[model samples]
Target: MKLVIVMLGLCCYSALASAGDNSKGKELFQTNCAACHGEHGEGKHGVAPRLAGDASRWSLKLFERAVLSGVDDNGRKLKLMMPHWQNGSFKGDNGNAPSKEEIAAIHQYLKHPR
Candidate 1:
């Protein structure tokens, strides 16, 4: 029984560590991405592609690359408008770059926007 409990606790902790916080994601998106991606990630016409469900097929690594390096899944460079966020170009939240956890949260929100 103790072994089982320990296993269950580890599983729960792992799940929590992997999952991103939806609320934090929404806030970060609104503060940093909404201007270009739209309030609900609907995207602006002639500016940015719609983000809602756009990354449904993307792995987290690919998403991270695109966000942090401006490289698409095809290994091609994204448009110039896409900021390489790793450079800390974003002006939101005291102009600091988004952490990995924060990026994951944004991905979660984009994956399942409410």
Candidate 2:
């Protein structure tokens, strides 16, 4: 039981350690999502739609479905040219599975812009 607790604790720490912050997310967005989505998510990538101000209109459901499944709620295809990062995320020198908490963070960031 003690060993189990220790292992679980370590897992939690590792997750938090790799957990993405927005600065990291923005950087990731630039390199991975920006080409198609545009740097500020402003869209106009010829294939991609404008991303800025898009999330405010969407429920998290819409957002998640689009990100994970590569399809929008309206059943239109989206950014198929890009890789999926639904179950996880990658940034910088490391790749990791983003926890639900992390996804929520990214969602919130997108939903509200500066």
Per-model TM against the reference: 0.75, 0.58
lDDT of each model, Cα atoms only? 0.81, 0.63
Cα RMSD to the true fold for all candidates: 3.3, 7.4
lDDT of 2 by residue, 1-114 (tens): 999999999999988866533664565456566677766777764667776688536787777667776777687876657456764465553666545554455565554433
Give, for candidate 2, the lowest lDDT window spanning 10 residues.
105-114
Clashing pairs in 2: none
Candidate 1's error at 9, in angstroms?
11
Which residue segments of model 2 deviate by more than 4 Å? 1-25
Candidate 1 lDDT over residue span 59-98, tens digit each: 8888889899999889999997988899874455677776
Quote the positional error of residue 28 for candidate 1 in Å: 0.5
Candidate 1 lDDT score at position 39? 87
